[model samples]
Target chain A: MLNYLARRLVLALITCAAISVLTFVIIRLPPGDFVDAYIANLASNGSMVSAEQAVAMRHEYGLDRPVVVQYALWMGRVVRGDFGVSMMWRRPVTEVIGDRLWLTMAISVSALFLTWTIALPIGIYSAVRQYSIGDYIATLLGFMGLAIPNFLLALILMYAGFRYLGLSVGGLFSSDYAQEAWSLAKFWDLMKHIPLPACVLALAGTAQLIRIMRANLLDELRKPYVVSARAKGLSELHVVLKYPVRAALNPFASSIAYLFPYLVSGSIIVSLVLGLPTVGPLLLQALVAQDMFLAGTIVLLLGIMTVIGTLISDLLLMWIEPRIRLRGRA
Target chain B: MVEQVMTNPGAIESGGHMLSVRDLAVEFGQDRGSVRALDGISLDLRAGRVLGVVGESGCGKSVTARAILGILDRPGRLVGGRVLLDPGTSAEQNLAALDPNGAALRAVRGGRIGLIFQEPMTALSVHYTVGNQIIEAIRAHKTLSKAAARAATVELLREVGIPRPELRIDAYPFQLSGGLRQRVGIAMALACAPDILIADEPTTALDVTTQAQILALLRRLQRDKGIALMLITHDMGVIAQMADDVAVMYLGRIVEFAPVRRLFAAPRHPYTRALLRSVPDIRAVPRARLATIGGTVPHPGARPTGCAFHPRCQEMIAGRCETTAPSPVPAGLEGASCFHAESVVQEAVV
Candidate 1:
C-alpha cells in the first residue's frame, strides 16, 4: 500500500508537469502578447503609448524572452508562490483570484453534497420500488430536471423573485451586504441568496446522478450475490444497502475525478446569469483580455485538482472493493 | 395422500422427520398461463442422512429446494403445500403456513434451515471478504461480538480445509478458487448449525475431482454435525455415492423414491430404469452410442394431459396412461408413481 501511494504521488507529479507545459503552450499559441493587446486597447481609446515604452512593458513582463525561457521563468516563480501579474487587472494573479476562489469552492462543495444527498435516496427508492408509482414520479422529475438548462432556470428564478416577491435576486448578496464588512447580517444575507444559484447548479447533476445510480443499482440487484445475501435472512433494506449498493456506487465514486474540476470551475454562463463571482467567469475574462498568467494559473489549478481527484477516487475504490485490493497478489 | 402416509415407513422413526414436505406445490405465472412447477411433491428428510434428489434440468429439483427455503423469486408462488419442520421440538410447526417475511419465518430461514446455491462463482458478494460474509451469517442468529464472530469465521475457514485461515479471512471471494468459494458457501450455510442443509446442485459447477472432494467433505460434515442434508443434482452417479435415500423426479414430480441400494437394484419406474441405463459403464463396448431417454421434456406451458412421461415412455399403456396420472403406490420397499409398477416388478423378478 505504501508502494502504491508512492507510485501515485510520482504519477501525480508527472501529470501536473505535463498540464503545466500544455497550459503554457496553449495560452501562448495565439499571436501577439499582453503588450500588443494593451497597445491596441490604448490606440482604440484614442490614446497612445510610445514604442519605447511598449518595448519596456514587454521587457517588464519578460515577453522579450523565448517562449521556453519565459515558461521556465514563470514556472520557477510559481514554485515560490509568485503567479506573475494579471496584465488586464494589473495585480498579482493570486490577488485577482483572492476571495473568489474560496467562495466558488464553497458553493461547488455545497452543491455537490446537496446533489448526492438528494440523488442517493431518490435513486435507491426508484430502483428498489421499480415500476411503482414512486419510481414513475421520480423518473418524470429527473427527465424534467435534465431537460431544463441551468442558466434558463437561473434567469427564470431571478425574474420570478423580482416580479412576484418584489426582491432583487441576481447577485449572491444584497447591495447593502455587498460592501459591508463581515457581520451577522452579511452572513445571513449570504445564506438567503445561496439557495438559488446552488439549486440552479445542482439540478442537472442530481438528475444525472439519479439515473446513473438507479441503473447501476438495478443491474446489481439482479445479480446472484444479492439473492445469496437475502437467503442469509437479512432484511430487505439491509440486503440492498450492504451488498448491491456498494457495488452500484462504483460509477458514482469514479465520477469524483470530474467533480473536482467541475466544482472549481463551475458553469460560466450560470455564474454570469446569476451575477455571482466565481472562478469560471474570471477564467473566461482573463482569456478574453489576454491575461496569460491568470488564465494559465486557473487552468493549471484545475488540472491539479483533476489529478488529486483521480488519486482520491482510486484510493476510495480500493477501500470500498476488496476484490481490487487483493487482485494483484497470488 | 392416505396411501402416501401409510407407505412412508421412515415417518415412524423415533426422532421424527427433520423436515416433511407434504403435497408441496409451486406454480409460476407465465405470460400464457400459470405453469405448475412442483405438483403434490412429498418427501421426508431425517437427521444425519443425505436425501439425493436427482433429475434432468427443469425437473424442478432446484425449485423444490428453493420452496423449502422460502427463497423462490417473484412470479413463482407456493400454490399449495405444508413444510412441517420438527426441529426436534415439542411441537412441529408448518413453515409453509408462515408469512415469508414475518419474524417467525425469518428465524427459521438461515437459522434452522440453510441453503447453498449451484454456481459458487456468483453465490458470494464480491465486495465482501469470505470471512465477512461468514461472520454476517453467524451474527444473523447469534448475538456474538465482532471479535468473537471473526474468530468463528477463521475457524470455519480452517474447518473447510482452507489454508492459512487467519490470513485468508481477509481475502475476497474472487481471490479464492471455485472450490474454495463453494467451501465458503458451505461454511456460511453451516454457521448457524441449521437442522437441515439444502445443497442445490452444489457440485454441478465443480470439476469432477473437486466434486468428489466437496461430496466427501459434505458427507463428513453431515455425519459429524448430524444435520439433514438435501443434495439436489442431475448426476445419478453422485446420488449413488452420497445418498442414503434417492428421489427420481420427472417433469416436476417424484416418479420414484426409495432407499438408494434398493432403488438401484430394482428400479420400478420406466423413466428411472432408462435413466440408470443412460450412464456409460467403464466396461461398455468402446464405440457404442449411449442409451438416451427419447424426446425432450414437455414445455411447462404445454404439459401432456395425464402422466407427464407418457409421451416418451416405452412401457406406457395407451388407454390408462393417456387419461390418468398415476398416484404413488408401494412397490416392495419403495414408492413409484407408475401404473405398471406391478408389471415392472414382476418382470424384474422373472
Candidate 2:
C-alpha cells in the first residue's frame, strides 16, 4: 500500500508539472499579453502611453521574454509560494485568491454534500422499485435537473427567492454582512445565501449521479450475490443496502475524482450569475483581462485538486472493495 | 390433487418429509404476456435423504428452488402453491401462503431452510470475507455473541473442508479459487443448521474434478447433519450418485418422480428414458455417434397445449398427446405424468 501511495504521488507530481506547463501556454495563447490589455484599458480611459512606455511596462512585467523563459521563471517563483502579482488586481496572486478559494471550496463542498444526500436514497429507491410511480417521478425530475443549465437555474432560483420570499439571494452575503469580519451573524448570513447557488451548482451533478447510481444498483440487484443475501434471511432493507447498494457505490466513490475539478470549473457560470466570490469567477475575470499569474494559479490549483481527488478516490475504492486493493499490490 | 397426495403418501406417513411442495405455480410477466415458469411442480424433500431435481436449461429447476424459499426475482410471482415446511418440532407452516416480506417467512428463510446457489464466483459478496458472511447468516437466526458467531463460522469453514480456517476466515471471496469459494457458499448455507438445504446447480460452475469434490462434500455434509437435501442439477450421473429419489422436470412440470434405482432401471416416462439414453456411455462402440434427444425444450411462452414434453417425446401418442394434458398417475411410491407410461414401458420391452 505504501508503495502504491508513493507511486501515485510521483505520478501526481508529474501531472501537476504537465498542468502547469499547459496552463501557462494556454494563458499566453491569446494574441496579446497583459501589457497590451493594460495599455488598451488606459487608452479607453482617455489616456495615452508612448510605445516606449508600453515596452518599459512589458520589460517591467518580464513579458518580453520568450514563453519558455517566462514559464520557467514563473514555475521557479511558484515553487517558493510566490504566484507573482495579478496584473489586473495589482495584488499578489495568493492574496487575491486566499479567501475566494476558501469560499469557493465551502460552496463546492456543501453542494457536493447536498448532491450525495439527495442522490443516494433517490437512486436506490428508483432502482429497487423500478417502474413504480415514484421511480418515474424521480427519473423525470433527474432529467429536468440535467437538462436545465446551471446559470439559468441560478437566475430562476434567485428570481423566485426575491419574488416569493422577498429575500435577495444573489450574493454570498447580505449588505450588512458583506464587509463585516467573521462573526456568527456574518456566517449565518453567508449560510442563508449559499443554498441558492449551491443548489444550482449541484443540480446537474445530482441528476447525473442519480442516473449512474440507479443503473449501477439495478445491475447489482439482479446479481446472484443479492439473491444469496436475500436467501440468507436478511431483511429486505438489509439485503438491498448491504449487497447491491454497497456494490453500486463503487461508481459513486470513483466519481469523487471528477468532483474536485467539476466543482472548481463547473461552478463558473453559476458563480458569475450569482455574483459569488469564488475562484471560478475570479479565474474567468483574470483570463479576460490577461492576468496570467492569477489565471495560471487558479488553473494549476484545479489541476492539483483533480490529481489529489483521483488519489483520494483510488484510496476510497481500495478501502471499499478488496479486489481493487489486491490489484493495487500488483 | 388426491392422486398427488397419494403419490407421496409413504413420505407423509413416515413423517420424514421436511419440505413438501404441492402444485406450486410461478408466472413471469413479460411484454407479450405472463408465462408460467413453474406449472404445478410438486416434490417432497425427506429428512436424511437427497432428492435430485434433473432437467435441461430453462426447465424451471432453479425457479422451483427459489419458489420454495419464496425468493423468486421480480416479475415472477407465486401464482398458486403451497410449500409445507415441517421442521419436526414446530407445526407445519405453508411458506407460500406467508407474506414474502413478512417476519414469519424471514425467520423460516436461512433459519429452517438454507439455499446453496450455483456459480460460486457470483454467489458470495466480494466486499465481505467468507467468515463475515457466514457469521452474518449464523447471527441472523441465533442470538450468539459476535465472537461466538465468528468461532462458529470458522468451524463451519473447517467442516466444509476449507483448510487453514483461521487464516482463510479473513480472506475475501475473490481471493479464493472457485472450489474454495463454493466451499464457503456451502458453509454459509449450513451455518444456520437448517433442516433442509436447497442446492441449485451447486456444482454447475465448477470444473469436472471440482464438481465431483463439491458433490462429495455436499453428500457428506448432508448425511452428517441429516439435512433434507434438494440437489438440483442437469447431470444424470450426479443424480445417480447422490439422490435417494429423482425428479425429472420438463418445461416447468415434473414428468416423473420415483426412487433413484427404479427410475434408472425401469424409467416409465419416455422423456426420462430419452434423458438416460442421451447420457454418453464409455461401453459404447468406439467412434460411434453419441445419442442425443432430438429438439430443444420449447419456450415457456409457446408451450404445447398437452404434456410439455410431448413435442420432444418419441412415445408421444398421436392425437391424445397433442390435445390433452396428462395428469400424474400414482403407482405405489412413484408416479409419472404421461398418457402412455405403461405403453412406453411395454414398447421398450418389445
Candidate 3:
C-alpha cells in the first residue's frame, strides 16, 4: 500500500507537470500576448504611449524575455505562490481568482452532493424495477435532462424564479449582501441565491449518473451471486443492496476523476448566463482576453484537481475491491 | 387443460418421503406464447438417501432444483404444482402454495432446504470472503452471534476438506481453486443443516480427480449428517456411485425412476436404456463408435404431439405413441413413462 501510494503520487506529479506545460503553451498560442492586447486597446481608445514607456512596461512585466525563459520564470514564481498578474484585472492572478474560487467550489460541491444523493436511489430503483411505470418515468426524465442544455435550463429557471416567486435569480447573493463579509444573515442570503444555479449545473450530471448507475446495476443484478444470495433466503432488498449494489458502485467510483474537474469547470455558458461567479466564467474571460497567466493557472489548477481526484478514487476502489488491491500488489 | 394425477401422498409417506413434488409444471413465457419447461414431474425424497436426477443438458434437471427451492428466474411460472415438505409432522408445508416472498417460504428455503449450484466460481460473491458468505448463510436461518457464525463457518470449511480453513476463511471466492470453491459452496449449503440438500451439477465444472474427491466428500457428509441429498447431474457414473434412487429425465419429464440397482439392472424405458448404452465401456473394442441417442431433446415450443420423447425413441409405437402421452406405469419396483415398456424389455431379451 505504501508503494502504491508513492507510485500514485509520482504519477500525479508527472501529470501536473504535463498539464502545466500544456496550459502554458496553449495559453500562449493566441495571435498576441497581454502586452499586445493592452497596446491595441490603448490605440483603439485613441491614446498615445511613448516608445520608452512601452519598452519599460515590457521589461517590468518580463514580456521582452524569450517564451521559454518567461515560462520558467512564471513557473518558479508559481511554486512560490505567485501566479504572475492578470493584465485584464490589473491584479495578481491568484488574488483575482481567490474570491471566485471559494464560491465556485461551494456551488460545485453542493451540486455534486445533490446529484449523488438523488441519483443513487433513483438509479437503483429504476434498474431493480425495470420497465415499470416508475422506471419509464425516470428514464424519460433522465433523457430530458440530458437533452436540455444547462444554459437554456438556467435561463428558463431564472425567468420562472423572477416571474413566479419574485426572486432575484442571479449572482451569489442579494445586492446588499454581495460585498458583505461572513455573517449569519449574509450566509443565509448566499444560501438562498445558490439553488437556481446549482440545480441547473447538476441536472445533466445527475441524469448521466443515473443512466450509468442503472445500467451497471442491471448488469450486476443478473449475476449468479445475486441469484444464490436470494436462494440463501436473503430478502430481495438485502440481496440487491448487499451483493450487486457494491459491484455496481464501481462505475460510480471510476467517474470521480471526471466529476471533480466537471464540478470545477461545469456549464460555462450556464455560469455566464446566470451571472454566477465561478471559475468557468473567469477562465472563459481570461482565455478570450489573452490573459495567459490567469488562463494557465485556472487550467493547471483543474488538471491538478483531476490528478488528485483520480488518485483518491483509485485508493478508494482498492479499499472497496480486494481484487484491484491484490492485482496491484502482485 | 390436461387432467394429471397428483402424487399419491400415502404411497410417498409409506416410502418415508421427506419432500414430495406432485404434478409440478413450469412454463417460460415469451412474446408469442409460453412453453412448458417442466411438465408434470413428481419425485419423492427421503432423509439420508441420495436421489440422483440424471438428464442431458437443458432437460429440466436444474429447473427441477430451482422449482423445489422456489428460486426459479423471472418469466418462469409454476403453472401447477405442490412441493410438500413433511417437517416431521402430520401436515406437510406446501412450498408451491407459499407466497414466494413471504416469511414462511423464506424460513423453509435456506433453513429446511439448501442448494449448491454448478459453477462455484460464479455462485459465491467475489467481493466477499468465503467465510463471510458462509456466516451469512448460517445467520440467515439461525439466531447466532457473529462470533458463533464465524466459528461455525470455519468448522464447515474444515468439514468440507479444505486445508488450513482458518486462513482460507478470509480468502475470497477468486482466491480458491474450483474444488476449494465448491467445498465452500457445500459448506454454505450445509450451514443450516437443511433436511434436503439440492446439489445442482455440483461437480460438473470440476476436474475428474477433483470431481471424485467432491463426490466422496458429499457421500461422507451425507453419511455423517444423514441429510437427504438430491445430486443432479448428467453423469451416469456419478449416479451409480452416489445414489440410492435414480431418476432419468428427458424432454421435461421423468422417463424412468427406480432404485439405482434396479435402474441399472433392468432399465425399463428405451430412453434410459439408450442413455446407458451411450456410455462407453472400458471392455468394449476401442475402435468401435459409441452409441448415441438419435436426436436431440425437442425444443420446448415445438414439442412432439403426444409423448415428447417419441420422436427420438427407437421403440416408439407409431400410431399410439404419436397420438397419446403415456402416463407412468409401474414395472416391479420401477416406473417408466412408456406404453410399450414390457415389449421393449421382451424385445431386448429376444
**Candidate achieving the largest DockQ:** 2
How do the residues B237-283 of candidate 3 rate in per-residue lDDT, one tens digit apiece?
Answer: 99999999998988788889899999999888889999999998999
User: What is candidate 2's lDDT per residue for B170-282, written digit by digit as tens?
Assistant: 99998999999999999899888887899999998999999999999999988766778999999999999999999998999888988999999989888899989989899
Better of 2 and 3 by TM-score: 2
Model 3: lDDT of residue A39: 79
TM-score of 1: 0.88
Candidate 1 lDDT over A27-78, as tens digits, reads 9988988888888888999999999999999999899999899999999999
Fraction of native Cα-Cα interface contacts (under 8 Å, chains A and B) also present in model 2:
0.85
**Model 2 lDDT per residue over A1-330, tens place:** 778889988998899899998988888899999888988888999999899999998998899998889999999999999999988989999999988878888899989899999998999999999999999999999999899887888889889989999988778999998888999999999888888888888788899889988999999999999899889898999999988899888877777888888666647888888988988888889999999899999888888889989989888887887887877852
Interface RMSD of each: 1.2, 0.7, 0.9
Cα deviation at A290, candidate 3, in Å, is 1.2
Worst 10 residues of 2 chain B by lDDT: B1-10
The recovered share of true contacts, given per candidate in order, is 0.62, 0.85, 0.58
Instruction: Report how far residue B4 has shifted in candidate 1, in Å.
Output: 26
- lDDT, candidate 2, equals 0.87
The CAPRI-style docking tier of model 3 reads: medium
Q: Any residue pairs clashing in model 3, and if so which?
A: none
What is the lDDT ranking, best to worst?
2, 3, 1
DockQ of 3: 0.70
